[model samples]
Target: MSITSAINLFRQLTVDESQVAHQGQPHVVNETCLDLLLIEMVQVLRTSVAETSFAVPHGGLPPSDSLELPQSSESTTARSNEEQERATELLYYKVERVGFRIGQRLAERYAKDRPRFTDTLDIVKFICKDIWIKLFHKQVDNLKTNHRGVYILQDNKFRWLLRMSGSEGVAHATQQAAPYLWFPCGVIRGILANLGVDSTVSVKETNLPQCAFQIKINRAV
Candidate 1:
Protein backbone atom coordinates (compact mmCIF):
# COMPACT_ATOMS: atom_id res chain seq x y z
CA MET A 1 0.00 0.00 0.00
CA SER A 2 1.04 3.61 -0.35
CA ILE A 3 2.60 5.33 2.65
CA THR A 4 -0.46 7.50 3.13
CA SER A 5 -2.81 4.55 3.31
CA ALA A 6 -0.63 2.76 5.84
CA ILE A 7 -0.48 5.85 7.97
CA ASN A 8 -4.25 6.17 7.88
CA LEU A 9 -4.65 2.58 9.00
CA PHE A 10 -2.18 3.05 11.83
CA ARG A 11 -3.82 6.21 13.07
CA GLN A 12 -7.18 4.55 13.10
CA LEU A 13 -5.88 1.76 15.31
CA THR A 14 -4.08 3.71 17.98
CA VAL A 15 -5.25 3.29 21.57
CA ASP A 16 -6.98 6.09 23.44
CA GLU A 17 -5.00 8.18 25.89
CA SER A 18 -7.05 6.88 28.85
CA GLN A 19 -5.90 3.33 28.11
CA VAL A 20 -2.20 4.10 28.29
CA ALA A 21 -1.57 2.66 31.78
CA HIS A 22 -4.51 0.36 32.19
CA GLN A 23 -3.98 -2.25 34.96
CA GLY A 24 -0.34 -3.26 35.23
CA GLN A 25 0.41 -3.64 31.52
CA PRO A 26 0.90 -1.02 28.82
CA HIS A 27 -2.14 -0.55 26.62
CA VAL A 28 -0.21 0.74 23.64
CA VAL A 29 3.10 -0.30 22.17
CA ASN A 30 5.88 2.18 22.92
CA GLU A 31 6.64 4.97 20.45
CA THR A 32 10.33 4.86 21.32
CA CYS A 33 10.66 1.40 19.78
CA LEU A 34 9.04 2.56 16.57
CA ASP A 35 11.31 5.58 16.52
CA LEU A 36 14.34 3.36 16.89
CA LEU A 37 13.27 1.14 14.04
CA LEU A 38 12.74 4.14 11.76
CA ILE A 39 16.11 5.48 12.86
CA GLU A 40 17.83 2.28 11.85
CA MET A 41 16.19 2.44 8.44
CA VAL A 42 17.32 6.04 8.08
CA GLN A 43 20.89 5.04 8.89
CA VAL A 44 20.78 2.34 6.23
CA LEU A 45 19.24 4.72 3.70
CA ARG A 46 21.60 7.61 4.36
CA THR A 47 22.90 7.68 0.80
CA SER A 48 21.17 7.74 -2.58
CA VAL A 49 20.75 4.49 -4.54
CA ALA A 50 19.81 3.32 -8.02
CA GLU A 51 16.16 3.01 -9.09
CA THR A 52 16.36 -0.62 -10.13
CA SER A 53 18.29 -3.66 -8.89
CA PHE A 54 18.47 -5.55 -12.19
CA ALA A 55 20.98 -3.17 -13.72
CA VAL A 56 23.89 -4.68 -15.65
CA PRO A 57 27.48 -3.70 -15.09
CA HIS A 58 29.30 -1.40 -17.50
CA GLY A 59 29.41 -3.37 -20.73
CA GLY A 60 32.56 -4.12 -22.78
CA LEU A 61 33.00 -7.73 -21.68
CA PRO A 62 31.25 -9.94 -24.20
CA PRO A 63 29.91 -13.42 -23.37
CA SER A 64 32.76 -15.59 -22.09
CA ASP A 65 34.38 -17.96 -24.60
CA SER A 66 36.38 -20.56 -22.70
CA LEU A 67 37.78 -22.28 -25.80
CA GLU A 68 38.63 -19.07 -27.71
CA LEU A 69 40.77 -17.34 -25.07
CA PRO A 70 41.57 -18.42 -21.51
CA GLN A 71 42.85 -14.92 -20.59
CA SER A 72 39.58 -13.26 -21.67
CA SER A 73 37.53 -15.86 -19.77
CA GLU A 74 39.25 -15.01 -16.48
CA SER A 75 38.58 -11.31 -16.90
CA THR A 76 34.96 -11.97 -17.89
CA THR A 77 34.38 -14.03 -14.76
CA ALA A 78 35.96 -11.33 -12.61
CA ARG A 79 33.72 -8.71 -14.20
CA SER A 80 30.66 -10.89 -13.63
CA ASN A 81 31.52 -11.24 -9.96
CA GLU A 82 32.05 -7.52 -9.65
CA GLU A 83 28.67 -6.84 -11.23
CA GLN A 84 26.98 -9.31 -8.92
CA GLU A 85 28.60 -7.61 -5.93
CA ARG A 86 27.33 -4.24 -7.19
CA ALA A 87 23.74 -5.25 -6.46
CA THR A 88 21.27 -2.34 -6.26
CA GLU A 89 19.84 -1.92 -2.76
CA LEU A 90 17.33 0.94 -2.92
CA LEU A 91 14.88 -0.49 -5.39
CA TYR A 92 14.37 -3.41 -3.09
CA TYR A 93 14.27 -1.03 -0.18
CA LYS A 94 11.30 0.82 -1.64
CA VAL A 95 9.36 -2.37 -2.13
CA GLU A 96 10.16 -3.71 1.33
CA ARG A 97 9.37 -0.43 2.98
CA VAL A 98 5.93 -0.57 1.46
CA GLY A 99 5.37 -4.04 2.78
CA PHE A 100 6.74 -3.19 6.20
CA ARG A 101 4.49 -0.17 6.57
CA ILE A 102 1.48 -2.08 5.35
CA GLY A 103 2.08 -4.90 7.78
CA GLN A 104 2.55 -2.55 10.68
CA ARG A 105 -0.60 -0.66 9.81
CA LEU A 106 -2.65 -3.81 9.35
CA ALA A 107 -1.41 -5.22 12.61
CA GLU A 108 -2.31 -2.05 14.40
CA ARG A 109 -5.75 -2.08 12.85
CA TYR A 110 -6.42 -5.64 13.91
CA ALA A 111 -5.33 -4.89 17.44
CA LYS A 112 -7.63 -1.92 17.71
CA ASP A 113 -10.82 -2.98 15.97
CA ARG A 114 -11.20 -6.70 16.69
CA PRO A 115 -12.99 -6.86 13.37
CA ARG A 116 -14.99 -9.83 12.14
CA PHE A 117 -15.18 -11.40 8.74
CA THR A 118 -17.77 -13.74 7.20
CA ASP A 119 -16.88 -13.67 3.54
CA THR A 120 -14.41 -16.06 2.12
CA LEU A 121 -11.15 -14.36 1.14
CA ASP A 122 -12.69 -10.95 1.80
CA ILE A 123 -9.89 -9.73 4.00
CA VAL A 124 -7.32 -11.32 1.76
CA LYS A 125 -8.76 -9.64 -1.27
CA PHE A 126 -8.85 -6.31 0.53
CA ILE A 127 -5.14 -6.67 1.32
CA CYS A 128 -4.33 -7.66 -2.24
CA LYS A 129 -6.24 -4.73 -3.63
CA ASP A 130 -4.84 -2.12 -1.33
CA ILE A 131 -1.31 -3.36 -0.76
CA TRP A 132 -0.12 -5.67 -3.54
CA ILE A 133 -1.99 -4.38 -6.56
CA LYS A 134 -1.35 -0.76 -5.70
CA LEU A 135 2.44 -0.98 -5.87
CA PHE A 136 2.80 -3.29 -8.88
CA HIS A 137 -0.47 -2.52 -10.73
CA LYS A 138 -0.73 -6.17 -11.74
CA GLN A 139 -3.21 -8.95 -11.24
CA VAL A 140 -2.11 -11.31 -8.46
CA ASP A 141 -3.09 -14.94 -8.72
CA ASN A 142 -3.02 -17.32 -5.79
CA LEU A 143 -0.86 -20.25 -6.88
CA LYS A 144 -1.14 -23.96 -6.21
CA THR A 145 2.05 -25.92 -5.59
CA ASN A 146 3.61 -28.81 -3.80
CA HIS A 147 4.26 -27.68 -0.21
CA ARG A 148 3.09 -24.20 -1.29
CA GLY A 149 6.32 -22.37 -0.57
CA VAL A 150 5.05 -18.97 -1.79
CA TYR A 151 2.25 -17.16 -3.59
CA ILE A 152 3.27 -17.06 -7.24
CA LEU A 153 2.66 -13.69 -8.85
CA GLN A 154 3.50 -13.85 -12.55
CA ASP A 155 6.29 -11.36 -13.14
CA ASN A 156 5.89 -11.81 -16.88
CA LYS A 157 2.77 -9.67 -16.80
CA PHE A 158 3.83 -6.68 -14.68
CA ARG A 159 7.57 -7.11 -15.36
CA TRP A 160 8.82 -6.37 -11.86
CA LEU A 161 10.90 -8.95 -10.03
CA LEU A 162 14.08 -8.13 -8.17
CA ARG A 163 12.35 -4.92 -7.10
CA MET A 164 10.02 -6.94 -4.90
CA SER A 165 12.58 -9.06 -3.13
CA GLY A 166 14.92 -7.49 -0.59
CA SER A 167 17.65 -10.06 -0.10
CA GLU A 168 20.83 -9.02 1.69
CA GLY A 169 18.92 -5.76 2.20
CA VAL A 170 18.71 -5.32 -1.61
CA ALA A 171 17.55 -6.74 -4.90
CA HIS A 172 20.52 -7.09 -7.26
CA ALA A 173 20.67 -7.68 -10.98
CA THR A 174 17.19 -6.31 -11.64
CA GLN A 175 18.04 -3.02 -13.34
CA GLN A 176 20.66 -4.60 -15.55
CA ALA A 177 19.69 -4.54 -19.21
CA ALA A 178 17.55 -7.57 -18.52
CA PRO A 179 14.37 -7.83 -20.60
CA TYR A 180 11.75 -8.07 -17.86
CA LEU A 181 11.21 -7.33 -14.17
CA TRP A 182 12.35 -9.97 -11.67
CA PHE A 183 11.28 -10.20 -8.06
CA PRO A 184 12.83 -12.57 -5.55
CA CYS A 185 10.76 -14.53 -3.00
CA GLY A 186 12.05 -12.65 0.02
CA VAL A 187 9.91 -9.60 -0.75
CA ILE A 188 6.70 -11.37 0.24
CA ARG A 189 7.83 -11.96 3.79
CA GLY A 190 6.59 -8.61 5.03
CA ILE A 191 3.20 -9.15 3.42
CA LEU A 192 2.75 -12.48 5.12
CA ALA A 193 3.93 -11.10 8.42
CA ASN A 194 1.52 -8.17 8.29
CA LEU A 195 -1.28 -10.39 7.01
CA GLY A 196 -0.79 -12.45 10.16
CA VAL A 197 0.21 -15.50 8.22
CA ASP A 198 3.19 -17.80 8.69
CA SER A 199 6.60 -16.82 7.40
CA THR A 200 9.03 -18.85 5.20
CA VAL A 201 7.80 -17.98 1.71
CA SER A 202 10.15 -19.23 -1.05
CA VAL A 203 10.54 -18.68 -4.78
CA LYS A 204 12.20 -21.50 -6.71
CA GLU A 205 11.82 -20.17 -10.26
CA THR A 206 14.70 -19.57 -12.60
CA ASN A 207 14.05 -17.58 -15.78
CA LEU A 208 11.03 -18.72 -17.76
CA PRO A 209 11.24 -20.85 -20.86
CA GLN A 210 10.80 -18.83 -24.10
CA CYS A 211 9.69 -15.78 -22.08
CA ALA A 212 12.21 -13.27 -20.80
CA PHE A 213 12.85 -12.79 -17.06
CA GLN A 214 9.83 -14.74 -15.83
CA ILE A 215 9.73 -16.29 -12.36
CA LYS A 216 7.08 -17.79 -10.06
CA ILE A 217 6.56 -18.02 -6.31
CA ASN A 218 5.54 -21.01 -4.15
CA ARG A 219 4.81 -21.41 -0.49
CA ALA A 220 7.14 -23.57 1.55
CA VAL A 221 5.29 -26.80 2.20
Candidate 2:
Protein backbone atom coordinates (compact mmCIF):
# COMPACT_ATOMS: atom_id res chain seq x y z
CA MET A 1 0.00 0.00 0.00
CA SER A 2 1.10 3.63 -0.50
CA ILE A 3 2.52 5.55 2.44
CA THR A 4 -0.50 7.89 2.44
CA SER A 5 -2.85 4.94 2.67
CA ALA A 6 -0.75 3.41 5.41
CA ILE A 7 -0.79 6.64 7.42
CA ASN A 8 -4.55 7.13 7.05
CA LEU A 9 -5.16 3.56 8.09
CA PHE A 10 -2.93 3.86 11.12
CA ARG A 11 -4.55 7.10 12.22
CA GLN A 12 -8.07 5.84 11.62
CA LEU A 13 -7.58 2.56 13.41
CA THR A 14 -5.36 3.75 16.24
CA VAL A 15 -7.66 6.58 17.24
CA ASP A 16 -10.88 5.93 19.16
CA GLU A 17 -13.80 5.01 16.91
CA SER A 18 -15.72 8.00 18.21
CA GLN A 19 -12.86 10.27 17.25
CA VAL A 20 -12.87 9.02 13.68
CA ALA A 21 -14.35 11.59 11.30
CA HIS A 22 -17.62 10.16 10.12
CA GLN A 23 -17.90 12.97 7.57
CA GLY A 24 -15.58 11.22 5.15
CA GLN A 25 -16.23 7.74 3.69
CA PRO A 26 -12.78 6.17 3.94
CA HIS A 27 -12.65 2.43 4.56
CA VAL A 28 -12.60 1.75 8.27
CA VAL A 29 -10.33 -1.12 9.22
CA ASN A 30 -11.45 -3.13 12.21
CA GLU A 31 -9.49 -2.41 15.37
CA THR A 32 -8.42 -6.08 15.45
CA CYS A 33 -6.62 -5.60 12.12
CA LEU A 34 -3.13 -4.88 13.48
CA ASP A 35 -1.68 -4.88 9.99
CA LEU A 36 1.77 -3.87 8.68
CA LEU A 37 0.94 -0.23 7.91
CA LEU A 38 2.43 0.91 11.22
CA ILE A 39 5.45 -1.31 10.68
CA GLU A 40 6.37 -0.02 7.20
CA MET A 41 6.09 3.62 8.23
CA VAL A 42 8.67 3.20 10.96
CA GLN A 43 11.18 0.98 9.16
CA VAL A 44 11.67 3.41 6.27
CA LEU A 45 13.34 5.94 8.56
CA ARG A 46 15.70 3.51 10.27
CA THR A 47 18.03 2.22 7.50
CA SER A 48 17.90 5.04 4.96
CA VAL A 49 19.83 8.13 5.99
CA ALA A 50 22.43 9.03 3.36
CA GLU A 51 20.27 8.00 0.38
CA THR A 52 17.35 10.38 1.01
CA SER A 53 16.83 13.42 -1.26
CA PHE A 54 15.01 15.52 1.35
CA ALA A 55 18.50 15.75 2.83
CA VAL A 56 18.85 18.53 0.24
CA PRO A 57 16.59 21.56 -0.05
CA HIS A 58 13.50 22.04 -2.25
CA GLY A 59 11.68 25.24 -3.26
CA GLY A 60 8.13 26.58 -3.91
CA LEU A 61 6.50 26.85 -0.46
CA PRO A 62 3.72 28.95 1.04
CA PRO A 63 3.64 31.38 3.97
CA SER A 64 2.26 30.29 7.33
CA ASP A 65 0.99 33.49 8.97
CA SER A 66 -0.03 31.45 12.01
CA LEU A 67 3.61 30.86 12.85
CA GLU A 68 3.99 34.44 14.04
CA LEU A 69 3.92 35.12 17.82
CA PRO A 70 2.43 37.93 19.93
CA GLN A 71 4.06 41.15 21.10
CA SER A 72 6.11 41.14 24.29
CA SER A 73 4.06 43.88 25.91
CA GLU A 74 0.70 42.20 25.26
CA SER A 75 -1.16 39.98 27.72
CA THR A 76 -2.74 36.51 27.61
CA THR A 77 -4.76 36.09 30.78
CA ALA A 78 -7.79 34.35 29.28
CA ARG A 79 -8.49 30.86 30.49
CA SER A 80 -9.19 29.58 26.96
CA ASN A 81 -5.97 31.03 25.51
CA GLU A 82 -4.05 29.30 28.25
CA GLU A 83 -5.81 26.03 27.50
CA GLN A 84 -5.15 26.01 23.72
CA GLU A 85 -1.50 26.79 24.32
CA ARG A 86 -1.30 23.87 26.73
CA ALA A 87 -3.04 21.57 24.29
CA THR A 88 -0.63 22.53 21.50
CA GLU A 89 2.50 21.74 23.54
CA LEU A 90 1.03 18.54 24.94
CA LEU A 91 0.28 17.29 21.44
CA TYR A 92 3.67 18.41 20.05
CA TYR A 93 5.54 16.28 22.59
CA LYS A 94 3.20 13.39 21.96
CA VAL A 95 3.91 13.59 18.21
CA GLU A 96 7.67 13.52 18.84
CA ARG A 97 7.37 10.36 20.94
CA VAL A 98 4.95 8.69 18.57
CA GLY A 99 7.26 9.34 15.59
CA PHE A 100 9.98 7.25 17.24
CA ARG A 101 7.45 4.55 18.06
CA ILE A 102 6.30 4.50 14.46
CA GLY A 103 9.88 4.37 13.19
CA GLN A 104 10.70 1.36 15.35
CA ARG A 105 7.71 -0.54 14.05
CA LEU A 106 8.57 0.39 10.43
CA ALA A 107 12.16 -0.94 10.61
CA GLU A 108 10.83 -4.48 10.80
CA ARG A 109 8.28 -4.10 8.00
CA TYR A 110 10.87 -2.80 5.53
CA ALA A 111 13.50 -5.46 6.16
CA LYS A 112 13.25 -6.04 2.41
CA ASP A 113 11.72 -2.98 0.43
CA ARG A 114 14.62 -0.71 1.48
CA PRO A 115 15.79 1.20 -1.59
CA ARG A 116 15.54 5.02 -1.97
CA PHE A 117 13.47 8.12 -1.02
CA THR A 118 10.32 6.16 -1.80
CA ASP A 119 10.82 4.18 1.40
CA THR A 120 12.26 6.92 3.62
CA LEU A 121 11.01 10.54 3.54
CA ASP A 122 7.62 9.57 2.17
CA ILE A 123 6.90 7.61 5.29
CA VAL A 124 8.15 10.50 7.41
CA LYS A 125 5.42 12.64 5.83
CA PHE A 126 2.89 10.00 6.74
CA ILE A 127 4.26 9.88 10.26
CA CYS A 128 4.04 13.65 10.54
CA LYS A 129 0.42 13.67 9.40
CA ASP A 130 -0.63 10.86 11.72
CA ILE A 131 1.04 12.35 14.78
CA TRP A 132 -0.28 15.81 13.94
CA ILE A 133 -3.92 14.79 13.57
CA LYS A 134 -3.94 12.24 16.35
CA LEU A 135 -2.87 14.93 18.80
CA PHE A 136 -4.40 18.23 17.60
CA HIS A 137 -7.57 16.56 16.29
CA LYS A 138 -7.11 18.53 13.03
CA GLN A 139 -5.09 18.24 9.87
CA VAL A 140 -1.99 20.41 9.39
CA ASP A 141 -1.60 21.63 5.84
CA ASN A 142 1.72 20.40 4.50
CA LEU A 143 4.06 22.89 2.82
CA LYS A 144 7.21 21.39 1.39
CA THR A 145 8.92 24.34 -0.28
CA ASN A 146 8.37 28.02 -0.80
CA HIS A 147 10.41 31.22 -0.69
CA ARG A 148 13.59 29.11 -0.59
CA GLY A 149 14.27 27.93 2.96
CA VAL A 150 10.88 27.88 4.71
CA TYR A 151 8.44 24.98 5.02
CA ILE A 152 5.42 24.97 7.27
CA LEU A 153 3.33 22.22 8.83
CA GLN A 154 0.41 24.28 10.06
CA ASP A 155 -2.32 23.42 12.56
CA ASN A 156 -5.49 23.42 10.42
CA LYS A 157 -7.90 24.40 13.15
CA PHE A 158 -5.62 26.51 15.34
CA ARG A 159 -4.97 29.41 12.96
CA TRP A 160 -3.74 32.02 15.37
CA LEU A 161 -0.44 33.78 14.64
CA LEU A 162 2.03 30.99 15.60
CA ARG A 163 4.97 33.18 16.36
CA MET A 164 8.04 31.29 17.65
CA SER A 165 10.42 34.28 17.24
CA GLY A 166 11.11 35.22 20.84
CA SER A 167 10.39 31.97 22.63
CA GLU A 168 13.65 31.95 24.57
CA GLY A 169 12.98 35.40 26.07
CA VAL A 170 9.40 34.86 27.19
CA ALA A 171 10.11 35.14 30.91
CA HIS A 172 6.48 34.53 31.79
CA ALA A 173 6.26 31.50 29.49
CA THR A 174 6.13 28.44 31.66
CA GLN A 175 5.62 25.05 30.02
CA GLN A 176 2.10 26.31 29.33
CA ALA A 177 2.69 28.91 26.58
CA ALA A 178 2.09 28.47 22.84
CA PRO A 179 5.86 28.72 22.15
CA TYR A 180 6.12 25.28 23.71
CA LEU A 181 3.83 24.10 20.94
CA TRP A 182 5.49 26.41 18.46
CA PHE A 183 8.74 24.56 18.96
CA PRO A 184 12.16 25.82 17.94
CA CYS A 185 14.14 24.27 15.11
CA GLY A 186 16.34 22.57 17.72
CA VAL A 187 13.41 20.43 18.86
CA ILE A 188 12.93 19.18 15.31
CA ARG A 189 16.61 18.35 15.09
CA GLY A 190 16.49 16.30 18.26
CA ILE A 191 13.33 14.55 17.10
CA LEU A 192 14.96 13.68 13.80
CA ALA A 193 18.04 12.30 15.56
CA ASN A 194 15.95 10.09 17.85
CA LEU A 195 14.41 8.55 14.72
CA GLY A 196 17.95 7.45 13.67
CA VAL A 197 19.06 9.90 10.99
CA ASP A 198 22.43 10.40 12.73
CA SER A 199 22.89 14.06 11.86
CA THR A 200 24.01 17.18 13.76
CA VAL A 201 21.46 20.02 13.95
CA SER A 202 21.46 23.70 14.89
CA VAL A 203 18.75 26.42 15.18
CA LYS A 204 18.80 30.29 15.18
CA GLU A 205 15.95 32.74 15.60
CA THR A 206 15.40 36.25 14.25
CA ASN A 207 16.05 38.84 16.93
CA LEU A 208 13.22 41.09 15.77
CA PRO A 209 10.99 42.81 18.32
CA GLN A 210 8.03 40.43 18.58
CA CYS A 211 8.39 38.80 15.16
CA ALA A 212 11.19 36.38 15.95
CA PHE A 213 11.88 33.05 14.32
CA GLN A 214 13.92 30.02 15.34
CA ILE A 215 14.82 29.43 11.71
CA LYS A 216 17.87 27.87 10.04
CA ILE A 217 18.82 24.20 10.49
CA ASN A 218 22.51 23.54 9.81
CA ARG A 219 23.99 20.07 9.61
CA ALA A 220 26.87 19.69 12.05
CA VAL A 221 30.50 18.93 11.33
C-alpha lDDT of all candidate models, in order = 0.40, 0.37
lDDT of 1 by residue, 24-136 (tens): 45444444443343333333432223312233234434444523655666787886676545544443454355445555555444434536543324333444454444343
What does candidate 2's lDDT look like per residue over 13-97, in tens digits? 4334443476455555663343333333334432232123223212222222344755343344463354445544444444344
RMSD of each: 12.5, 18.5
How much is the lDDT of residue 85 in candidate 1? Answer: 53
Q: lDDT score, residue 168, model 1? A: 42
TM-score of 2: 0.29
lDDT of 2: 0.37
The regions of model 1 sitting more than 4 angstroms off are 1-47, 50-80, 89-98, 106-126, 129-149, 154-188, 198-221
